[model samples]
Target: MSETHVPARRVVVIGGGISGLAAAHRLVDGGAQVTLLEASGRLGGKLYAGQIAGVAVDLGAESMLARRPEAVNLARAVGLADRLCLPAASAAGLYTRGALRPMPTGHVMGVPGDVAPLAACGVLSDAGLTRIGRDAELPRDELGEDVGIGTYVAARLGREVVDRLVEPLLGGVYAGDAYQISMRAAVPQLYEAARAERSLTEGVRAIQRRAAAGPAAGGPVFMGIDGGVGGLPLAVADAVRAGGGDIRTHAPVRRLARTGSGWSVVTEDGTALTADAVVVALPAPAAASLLAADAPGAAAELGTVEYASMALVTMAFRRAEVAGLPNSRGFLVPSVDGLTIKAATFSSHKWGWVAQGDPELFVLRTSVGRYGDEADLERDDPELVARSLADLHTTVGLTARPVATRVERWDGGLPQYPVGHLDRVARVREQVAGLPGLRVCGAVYDGVGIPACVATAHTAADELLGLLATVPAA
Candidate 1:
């Protein structure tokens, strides 16, 4: 990505989400002129925090994986370290067989390293438990480099484990079918171990041992901000401005093309901005559209990528109205259970800040829709809210209706990592590499976690910096 000798390098980041914000900030910090463009009126994409019944709450993602330093480190770098907070209770449960069962530990993506808990908890039937015991004795034969997580786990363990345990856990993350999700892309540690170890349990045990040896291994798995995870992008944008970068919302980039010694970005409003380098931090579809003419091969591959959409319905109720709420954080439902709602979180019970201002208002959230379940989200807000309350009533036995409800629909929110997704992404990058001073970074590429996205932003910025290294000063 090296550039020819030039003076006063300018950069245009075509997105205002967290990743775009990170890129713009990095360019500014490098003394490069930067301009950030966002299509919507708001800055944060899925990291939105708003109010419900006068109590502040997050309508999108509320927490982030703390073990990954990309997100937390960036938060601290943007002067938001003081606002960091951890979840009150990290314990979770699985709502299946019409009851809540404790989530078994010592597993990576619900692939239990120890099966004793599964036997005692009755998460799997007696016959299902018997199948698990046969894992160690299975044939030590050929397992491909990239295989479906559910298919491989079921072959080693059993179908019951994949359906009952692994399915729900993976579903909560990608909202895609487990049998089609890539093991290499989704869970690399487990995939790496499976290559050498004959037994899946043994492989998981080895991975856990390596993780526990890390510096921050024993701490809570996830964390949140004082207000919400949304504060992250807001703070980063402020830092970008402070460092002399321009951020424009409602300015969508429509196309990208190479200039004499730089790149040009065309916005929806017919605004043309040329820069020494450009970093595309957008979803696969949108990115593909802009790059169709410049990098058609990459665009074609990006067009093949699939996405899953879901809705988060936040509801607040009077504490007295919903009596006897449990101390647990949340519960997840398996798709096999034939339920409308996939998961629900007791927000007030999970976050201390949300519970601080309103002692009487108990806030909670319900998630609906998955890879193949978009019908539920199409329903009106009242219908979706009703279905969510019904699921709560059926499982937790809650009778009170919500005093305040907010519905946030994220269409095509999570990018699906189907089998061979990583290879496809590699090809996309390879195709784009032929074009100088142009790079793509977003949740669609490396990972969907906040940390992964930020790290990708850094990588893209470094690529741009690599180009700037060759430019000559006037």
Candidate 2:
């Protein structure tokens, strides 16, 4: 039998975030020469970790949903399965109306399956409850176009659900204004459920029925690595390097030009690298800036994708300081409550392994979103940290001041999938498809999660490899 010869193809991947790293790893595994360029000195874009009181704390994404298989599969492939850890389930509180109260039971992201807990829990008034109950009889919109999550929820579930429950819960995830986020992009399943069942409650019931028949329904709600969420990025980087990819930090790509044969990528150091293919896995704004001249229409559509800034403040406290705190994960702050912090995650309670069973050490991570209020995000780190601690004290009766604090600011970290995001993204995709040997993959296009980014990168890599295979041998 004759041997099939495959020519080597050089590929350049811009950005060193999870998406970019995943793309580089996938390309390298597919027998391509990969060079990953990161603007910063580190590989992980938003995934950062620092030591606090001798404990490693993740300042970026705290955990991953086990039901999302992409991240877990990537980790397992990279030999990081042993590092995985599950958090202990605990009650989550909600800071609303100048007090902290327990979140209603059977409430999935503020869309309640059962209204009894919300009514009995007093998260909303009798009038608010009545308004929510009216959603069952609310007419469904047959237009089927994408709508703002807040608008849809408010119109159907009432203002209380949007302002108190949805805003705090979903807002924390995207660091976006609920009224501005796309209902289809942010929570497509919710929209699907609504479409299938007519009522939000009934839709949730259907999902519950499906989940009950699945394996994850009885498992832990969230999972993380023993070291921290940072481990995921590190594992990805290791996989990329092991697969013969060149990962370079502090190497910012200045511009990308279409060469006769392929693409020429010029870096900040004034060096040009010609590659058979290029994968741009940066934020939409950065990607647009790099691709404007070559792919003008795509760049324009990419520019329409908006992003919001955020900061994560991790405070470490002594266990004795927060004596009466419940053994629960964390609490969210409703916008109606006029709270400065968006949400607080009990790092110690959520992931017991992260704390190494140190009863005296309690780690709390509070998030500040820059959606409607960039001013709040502009506050000094110390002031923001102080405010978060005070709110924690008021909400959970934690009197202990943090013994150590770490603050991480992510400027334009989360991309907001607005009402027309899907259309714009579709247009961007069409524009990119017009150019050969070029691809753009990232959270801005599909989803803004570790799993989604990895999956998108894998798909992009597969497409690029298929393109390489079609090329004649030199």
Candidate 3:
């Protein structure tokens, strides 16, 4: 008997970010013919690699959580395994109380697991420290449905903890206000702990104990590429092409429609691409615009998702000029501190590759702006640099001029996850799932981290592979 040969499934992935690249790589691996469409001239979305003062550095996102296997595994699959590097300096500090204080240990995202360590850090005032202890004495507070991280934590630990400790840490991730961010979506472990335990501090300690016992306990918390984390996307894109996937840049997808047996993706120049499966890997807004016709419910939910804009001011200074700079990784500034710059990373100190790239040049970057607080983003690049310098001077007493500077602004860079965000995501997925050969994945859905984005992309691709397996290939 003669065996039948199945034709390859045609898959189209919208957006050229890490999510899209990852999806394309997985789809190609599944024996599908994939085409990746990127609206921009480049592939990496937030992961951007650039140079200053003849030294290579990351202009966008710099690191990924090492505990998450998705991103690191993807990097290994893309030939970057040998290039992986760990952080040179892991200790980070908080710039508050008119000084740079060490980040407190025994906390889960700024929620104190032990009062001794929290008090030792001194990020919070004496009264704030006392307020955290009260969490153990308070009556059991039910965390019904979903609640804001800031609102729930403040009720137990007071606003001082939320402002001084929580805000800066969460801001580093989402660039969002702590009071409005979703507890379930942002920190699910803490949310579950709060539900089971009355004392928030004990709940946090339980979490810490579990983490210590876990396999990832002694592992590095974060990982960086030898050159820059930004290079991951480029490497993934290269792998996709090597796997015979067609990747296109400057190919802005204008519309998407459900065809009789599959989907049709039309680009800005009116180029139509037919696909047996489609993965919408763009940001929330872009995904909303494309899904409006076929998946209106998902489109509406995506439209409701808000974003935060921020700018990164990268400066390279003479090593001799910045000797007074702190030897630690860097410091985060709380919004309550009334600072223009939110956080600063001592790149040369934090990444060994950066220091090795240029012995005489010291590089660092300062982030500015967040949700509902972006007036400083309107400032010119020079002014942003000056503002960063001023903040650095105030915090570290640095009064040196930079040899090279670059400002990178990301408008609508981060998605805000308010209360009920997980429900919103579920609804979107449910609606999209109804449409055969259609899936969505991005930072706007699972998480803003590189690993989360890659994980979502892999899930989307694997689902499409299964769906396409049942379809009659053309």
Candidate 4:
């Protein structure tokens, strides 16, 4: 390939979220002609930056995993790298057993390395502590090819560990049941180590040691932009256009079909664009519908993928009313608490930039609803906010009235990766591989975080470009 070799491939990307934007950016950056279509009027599906009480903050996804370089790299490529910022506070709390206790250390997603720390944390009862002691003595069981995170962890550490420690952390991320979420897909490193070590505690210790040796182990786990994560998509989309890619909002892809050596993508408005390759970076359901005609197996598998709906209630309160608030970042409520809200983040305390805009005003957000439990979302916005405020008063001693409130609802925000998710992804890829120039990527197929979506998009873009490289130029 020449240094300035321009590929004859015209790639059509369907979807307007970060995944699609990243794919388009990669394709265009690779010197390929591209056309990007989005169903919505604006880009950045789950990431939106908005103002509450004249203070700018992220109304959607606030941060990205810094350990993974895809998101950070994309930010740099789009000229927002210098704007990245870390959280002001790192420690988080767990509201369980009628008190707000410190989260345990030396664990990965509630999987503990030593039982003493868990006992010290007081999140567990005396009975739970007793069970943790007997964990290592338990007989070794047959390890399966794949299993649920709750099933495997509960079996080794007992139900108390899974309920108190594991569930809350996992719930905060997946918004799904621990027993149904895939151990392999959700936390593959720990699950894979569990297969090698007979004792789960020992396995976790080994995993921790390996992490400690790695360069990124003790570094800040997450990062956010100075403005908001929502700005990331817009910057990348701008870069895509600057690279000569055509990006159109409200151009939802209606039909995608193979045309001889290339593919033809039709928009909802009946506009057709023929391209040498096609990348479908969308939700599982939407991707399934578009791929049903050509890759029925993949489509069927995609259709089986489930999702979890959630709502975020952002509230701004007078600073004096929350004077005696906890100094930590936030607190997570386990389902066992029977609380309407699952988690809450103190935005003003967590992000210094959010506070810089208004020091006298305190801002926070509470998340409601999950995979199988969405009754909380059915209530009106006022009802949800009242419940959240009530819980905050009880948990952290807040007696404040909000100056402003914003409620954002995501019907199917998170895709539930059930057991055998990795295997299912493999099958989908195998089926799609049979097609010459078709590919799929997004939160549905790979990881759900911002970095994971970007990484998947880059992979899809590379795959399509590779296929085009093999073809003879027109």
Candidate 5:
């Protein structure tokens, strides 16, 4: 193993999303030659921000919860700590039964922890409230593995809670259908608490007590950059470049094949790059296509993980024009409401600086999540926009039309963590371990939030770096 006879190993990372960027940055910091390839021209995959009427408008995730430290830590690592802005203190609403009602306080994922709020909110009928109040005394299940959120909530708190409250709140956060999402995967803490205390209500109270004793449980309020969340990704890209890592846009990876000693990554442009190790930090489908032959079982399993399409329709209007809308953060519509829009965020109200003029231009970010409904996704952009506006007007009494509108369609934006998702992820992990010099990291495995992606990338980077250190130098 003489120095002249040994060859330096290069690591190539596919995808330029936050996960890929984080992995590449970590590898470069560990003295490895790294090249990041992104199919799209832009760096951030889902994080997009732009200016409208002299105000920054975010089309992707508006902000990340500070309680989740991964995104916050990554931002600080990339010199973005000074740019963080917390959302204003305000309540959110729920659109149910053709009316916008205030969300009951002391709720964890729309599950009532305190009975007083649920009793007074009027979002639930007297019968529904009585049924929910009985959950504290309901018979407990001792041996439940992974159950659907709908089944778990409905069984314990009655069907009304699941349909009108829990479904919409969780669906809005995950962009998923409640009937399919796993209680274990989506809200493990809630499940754990239920198992421990044998009552959902009591479990929440215990967790709240623990949180109050500690340094605030929900972390910092949802925080975004002054410019927008896009700034965070841009900052990460800059840091990667500054650390001597190459990031190539418009470089779509076609396939990954293991070679005699390392690997060969073929690009869509018919170019191939050789690397000692490769990290596939992409959406599950994209990653599956690349690893189909090299890791068939893993690829097949990855393909089983489905994704949902969505569109964000951002409309800006004068404050007086929509005066009837409550001064809340936003509102979510239950599926029972049969609304085209799943939820809408009062962007200007959430943050103080988002408004532009004397009339206080308000930005409403409306989301349309299409899980199994291809017809919903097929609607024309204009038609979709019109329907969304109509829904908003009818729900919140808007007097004027939007002065400016922007629509962003994500064909496969959200990954759905169906029941047994944890088991599937475990199988994928096992398969990946059998393949040497290959790693997979993204939202598909664990969570679908900014923090989860960062955590996955960091963990993958650590594994890859350890493998690199053990390889004989060429």
Candidate 6:
């Protein structure tokens, strides 16, 4: 007797960023015939690998949060297990109050479980420290629906805490203003704690205690690849191709429309492609544009999402020319300090691979601009480098001129999660779910971190696989 046969699903993933690449990788693994379409000549989006001064470095994101298994698991699956490494010097500092101070521990996104350590670290003034202690006595804030992380923390711990500690830490992740970023969408764990506990400090303590007792307790907080985190998407793309998936670059998609049985994808050059299912993995704005035709509701919701722009100034200096470098990874400059550079990473100190790649040179990078503060990004690359150097000299006493410099500007690179962002995402998802054989995933929905994007992509792929299983072979 002949046996029943199940056909492989054909899935087309739009966008070549890490999220899109990860989705394509998972779809291929699930026995799907996948095709990944990228708008530009490259993949990786924010996870870009490049060289400066003949030394390899991640021009974009450098590491992934290791506590989540998605990113590390994907890396290992793509043959990067042996290349995983941790920061050589993990301890970081915050440049605040006219000095660089140790980043206080026992805090969740700058909200302290205990203020004593913050005082010891000199991250806050005596008055600021005293203000944080008042959280225990203050009445519970209603926090109706949702609230900005900064607004809630400031209401309880005082504005100084938000400006000095919270702003810079959150800035490093979102490149956004803390006062405008959503507590629920950006930091949901803290948001849950806020809803359950009356005092914000107690809420933070509960979170830390739960984390200590969780599965990932005492593990390395962040992880990097021996080469650079930017290589992740390239490796995933290779894996996808090895699985017989078609990957295309310089193929900007112009239109997406649902067909009678499947979906039709039209490229800007008028190349038409068809697929059994489709994953919309572009950034919010691009995703909105593509979904505007068939999934107008989802597109309208996505249109509300905003983005932030920033630039990274990567520099390499001769080791002999540098003196008195901080004995830590790097320092974050608070916006309140009125510094042009928001944060600086001593790449040579943070990643052993960077230092080993070239012992004679010291490498570092500075991030300039954030959400509403992007005027500095308009300056020429040389001027941006000079401003970064000026701040470095002021903060760390480093006055050496760089041997080589590369400026990477990320315009509308990060999505902003304002209040009601989660609700907006839910609405978009609900609207898209109404259409069969369609799913969406990216930093705009779940999170901006590498792990979160990978996880979201996996979810989209799995959902599409399940939906495809129900359809008859064409």
C-alpha RMSD of each candidate structure in angstroms: 2.2, 2.6, 2.5, 1.6, 3.3, 2.5
Greater lDDT among 4 and 6 belongs to 6
**Model 2, stretches more than 4 Å misplaced?**
1-7, 357-359
**Runs with alpha carbons beyond 4 Å of true place in candidate 3:** 1-7
Clashing pairs in 3: none
Q: What TM-score would every model get versus the actual structure?
A: 0.97, 0.95, 0.98, 0.98, 0.94, 0.98
lDDT of 5 by residue, 1-474 (tens): 011111255889999988899888777777778899999999888888876655688888878877778898889889988878787646888888778888888777777777788777678888888887887788876737888877877878888888888888877767788878998899888778888987888887877787778775656757787778877888898988997888999999887898868889989999998988899999998888888888888889999988888898888887777777778889988877898888889888787657643247777788887577546667888888898888888888766788888888988888999999999988888888777778989888889889899888888877877887788532
Total backbone clashes of candidate 6, pairs 3 or more residues apart or in separate chains: 0
List the candidate numbers ranked by TM-score, top first.
Answer: 3, 6, 4, 1, 2, 5
Better of 2 and 3 by TM-score: 3
Error of 5 at 287 (Å): 1.0
lDDT of 4: 0.89
* Model 4's TM-score against the true structure: 0.98
Give each model's whole-structure lDDT: 0.87, 0.82, 0.92, 0.89, 0.81, 0.92
lDDT of 1 by residue, 1-474 (tens): 113222367888998888899887777777778899999999988899899999889888888889888889889989988999988977888888778888877689989887798877768888877777777888774767699999998888888788889989998888888988999999988998988788888889889888889888888789899989998899999999997788999998887898867888888989999888889999999999988998999999999999999999999999898767777789889988888998999999899999995998999999999897688888999999999999999888899988989999999999999889999999999988888888889899878888899889988887777777776421
Runs in model 4 lying further than 4 Å from the true structure: 1-6
Report the error of model 1 at residue 382, Å. Answer: 0.5
Query: How displaced is residue 206 in candidate 5, in Å?
Result: 2.2
C-alpha-based local distance difference test score of model 2: 0.82
Write the residue-wise lDDT of candidate 6 on 1-474 in tens digits. Answer: 002222476789998999999988888888888889998999999999999999999999999999999999999999999999999998999999899999999999999989889979998888989988888898887768899999888888889999998999999999999998999999999999988998889999999999999999999999999999999999999999998899999999999999979999999999999888999999999999999988999999999888999999999999878757987889998899999999999999999999998999999999998999899999999999999999999999988999999999999999999999999999999999999989999999989999999988989988887778888643
In candidate 5, position 457 carries an lDDT of: 88
Query: Which pairs of residues collide in candidate 4?
Result: none
